[model samples]
Target: MDAKVRNNTAHSRYELTVDDATAVAVYEIRDGAIAFTHTEVPRSLSGQGVGSALARGALDDARAAGKKVVPLCSFIAAYIERHPEYKDLT
Candidate 1:
């Protein structure tokens, strides 16, 4: 099934949803950057690219907001490295 990435503005968070019940990953934005401060996916959801989707969503949001991304989390940092299109925004 396709995954969905959505922003929860009320909490400054991003959620990656697969199907209808699973929250594959969650992240936060702060200080003009997207911070993958918290991330989790059920064991069943692991290895399904959900984390990457979450990072991408967060980075996209940052770009749309005209802000740089710090990528404090290793996963997010690695994602940025792999997706050079986001480099200029960093």
Candidate 2:
């Protein structure tokens, strides 16, 4: 199933959903950009591309929001490096 990305204000987090209550990744927005700050996938959901999905979603969201990405998180930095399209916004 496709994942949906939702902002969870109460938690100050973004939720990546596989289904209701199934969050494979979570992130936070800091400064002017989206931060892939925290992430996780269920052991059952491992090796299924959930992390990449979350990264893409977060980056796309940042782009759409007209925000620059700082990529303080290692995974996010690596992802931005790999996807040069996002470098313009860094």
Which residue pairs overlap in candidate 2's backbone? none
For model 2, how does the per-residue alpha-carbon lDDT over 1-90 read when each residue is reduced to its tens digit? 466776676775556766444443344667756555656666666677776777777778778889887776687788789989889878
User: How do all models score by TM-score?
Assistant: 0.76, 0.75
lDDT of 1 by residue, 1-90 (tens): 466678787766677767654553344556656656656666767787777777777778778888877666676777779999988766
In model 2, which regions exceed 4 Å deviation? 19-30
TM-score, predicted candidate 2 vs. hidden true structure = 0.75
* Number of the top lDDT candidate: 1
What RMSD, rounded to one decimal, does every model reach?
2.3, 2.4
Candidate 1 clashing pairs, residues 3+ apart or interchain: none
Q: What is the lDDT of residue 70 in candidate 1?
A: 66
The deviation in Å at residue 79 for candidate 1 is: 0.7
